[model samples]
Target: MEMVDWNLAVATATRLVRPGPEVSREEARDIVAELRRHAKASEEHVRAFTRMEAANPEDADTPVLVVDRPGWVRANVAGFRELLAPLLGKVEERRASIPGGAVLGAVGGKVTGVEVGMLLSFLASRVLGQYETFAPASRELPGATESGGRLLLVAPNIVHVERELDVDPHDFRMWVCLHEETHRTQFTAVPWLRDHIQMEIQSFLGETEIDPSTLLERLREAAQSLTGAKPEAEEGADAEDEPSGESRGSIVELVQTPAQREILGRLTAVMSLLEGHADYVMDGVGPQVVPSVAEIREKFQKRRATGAGRLDQALRKLLGLDAKLRQYRDGERFVRAVVEEVGMDGFNKVWTSPNTLPTKAEIAKPADWIARVHRKAD
Candidate 1:
């Protein structure tokens, strides 16, 4: 039996997702058309700035879809299904071994579906755009044989953010497209990246050995951490000074074993690199391309720092978005430092192979990556 009612998850998300800002049908069409044009235009700027080109014709022609909040949620649900298949299959095997497992799964699936839907509904509005690496071939554009993945610009969210920030709509849209197009360039330029990340995720999930009984307890602890309730040992301690694994802001951190933590570190480093590089490229390409880039960046940074309300703050921590924000800051610093020390050509060596990728420590200390990767110069 399926562990999650995927169809139900979609329905629930569609029902719960908040409506985007009101706009006339004509205005919406204009926004969508402009976004598609900007996506294509940003590709050239990204390629020129990063000097990373698509590896093949298919990659070069990767599709860009302009979607609303519900469409974005649906696409992500599909991606989650594809990415979690291995782990779900494993869970199903374990469930089969237990008595009354079939009935338990039948009831649990709907509950899990609802939970997943709620999570997606929360995220659907926050995301601006994404390059979906695990997109299935069935969703590929016509005449495309294999899935090179597709870029999705969440139209409503993009419009919402630009309006909220009070920036030039045209400039803001192109700026957002610049960042997202950099991601498309990253995956398409590096032929091995998508598979490498997929393998790493599969390896991590393949090793998961969760006890069904203890799952609730772990979740409780994670919730406590997000709510600022400290354990006895951590009481009166500075949260900033806490060791890596001890600072549990999210359930992702709370449930991980030591081995899983190690894997997570590797994944974190990779994500930091990707996010940071995108920031770096966007800024690098901004001044010439985006006329109001300065104003947008300043306002966006302030918005990120201030965040929304208490409930939103707690939810951001619970979802590990706080850490994601850190990734952009930390990763951008690493990229900027590396590029300053060695030109973009030298930094490009990082894409040569998986072995050359920065470790978690190196992401914080650019000199370390430089020393390790460019030791011959020393």
Candidate 2:
């Protein structure tokens, strides 16, 4: 039984994400060149303020790509496929273990594919730049390497957002690069980070099971609701339970098993650390290199709080994006608070080993991590 047809997912995503106004080959080339110029300075800025024990493992000499919306969707779909490979394999095995499971498996795969495709369709327009630490399989797809563990700057989205914000275009571009390049430097310089995060994700996935019958039931109910067959009163409870517009407490509500929740807690704490550190590094470089940094940050934060339309806002809520946003704010606060009390060197200790990483509670109260970590040192 096939768990998911990744190719079909990619195709559906590509079709759903409407193509932007076409750019000539020359324009695309120029976009990549311009971003590359900014990237060099951005890298230098991050390095000047931060120190890591290990040398960056990534091919720093590699170029960044400037992709359009469809390209972004295709790349991310490939990434999701690679990322979820093991979990889906387990699902397939579990399905086959059941009596008359083949038909159920096929239905599950198709439904999952469509759901993922639709999610990516909306996300394609929102992301700016990413440092994909996990490399895509080179032998599998022709253009996979371009989308692998390298820097990706989505050109159209960047251009559109910058224009809309009325900020300094050059400065804004550099600000964006600072964030992405910091992430690149993070996984590269910390060496163990990539493997550590991948392992945690795998552990989380291992504990997560997809019950075909339960999934089928949910799909039937959803279909009925969409067709307006369900009464309004029946939908009230579901709407009320829909997370009250996103909060820290609701962050792990989607995970089913206790093991998954435990793994998710660890994963969330680590992400908070990584994302917080990146934000700290980006702002630490400050107004000297990125002169309009404050202005850019202010406008960007406002933009995130409110999306383009009701559909975009709804997607963000449904996708737990607000929860993700809170991570940045929460993490930044934790990092700032910790660094204020213990200096940069003391805060750097968190990156030394996974054991030293913050817990969810520690993330909310930075002093707890500082005291515990430093006490061990003494």
Candidate 3:
């Protein structure tokens, strides 16, 4: 039995997702066309700044898609389904062992689907763009040589954020494209990267030991942890001593075992590198390409720290987006530090192999990564 009704999830998200800013049909088309052009243009700037070219000629031709909120939800649902297939298969195997498991799954699937939909709907408005690394080859645009991945610029979200930030739409769109395009360049330029991340995800899923019986209870604990509500026993403990969920990391970290945490650390490091490197590239390439980049970055940073409202803040904590914000800051710091110590070419050594990539600890201390990778070379 399926644990989530994928179709239901899609329906719920599309029905509940908030509408984007008002725009005429002609205006929307213009926004999309401009975004597509910016995406293509950003690629050249990113490639030039990073000095990392696609390893394969085919990889260079990766598709750039401009999508609306519902379209973004649909694409992500497909990605989540692909990425979670292994874990879902494991759940199925365990369910088959239980006597009433099929019945439970039948009842639970729709509930899970709605919850997934709600989460996606919340995110649908917030994300500006993304590099969908796990995009299925079957979904690749016809005649595309490399089915490696596609870049998605969420048109509605971009328009919403730029208007909210009160920045130049043209510059803001290109700035957003710069960050996302850097991600596409990272994966394409380093042929092994996609496979490396897939292996890590598979490894992490392989280590999952889910129990159908206690799933709800585990989720309850995770929710409590996210909301900063301590159990009754720890209610009197020092608040400062007990770090909040935002500081501790994501719900994923709260639920994992020690071994799984180790794997998570490695994955976190890789993600930080990717996110940080993109931020670095965007800023590095900004002045020449994106005028008013300074105002955009400043406003964007403030907006990230202070979301719309209490409900939005709580959801960001729950979804681990607060941690994502930190990834951009912390990762950018790491990248900046390394580039300062040793020029851009020297920092490029990170993409040489997985072994050269910084560890979780090293992300916090660039000197450690520089010493380990560069000192050895010297």
Candidate number of the best lDDT: 1
Preferred candidate (TM-score higher): 1 or 3: 1
Cα lDDT tens digits for candidate 1, 1-378 = 699998889899999999999999999999999999999999999999999988876778788889998888888888899889989988888898999999999898999899899889989989999998685755332212344588899999999999999999999999999999999999989888989899888877876766786777877887687678977987788756767633477867776777887888899999999999999999999999999899999999999887678888888878888889989999999999999999999999999999999999999999999999999953
Q: Please, what is the whole-model Cα lDDT of each candidate in the order they appear?
A: 0.88, 0.73, 0.85
- Model 2: lDDT of residue 263: 87
Candidate achieving higher TM-score, 2 or 3:
3
Ranking by lDDT: 1, 3, 2
In the predicted model 3, the residue pairs found to clash are none
Q: By the lDDT metric, which is better: model 1 or model 2? A: 1
Model 2 quality (TM-score): 0.85
Local distance difference test, candidate 2? 0.73
Error of 2 at 120 (Å): 0.6
- State the displacement of the C-alpha of residue 307, model 2, in Å, after optimal TM-score superposition: 2.4
* Model 1: colliding residue pairs: none
- The residue-level lDDT of candidate 3 at 328 comes to 84
* All candidates: TM-score: 0.96, 0.85, 0.94
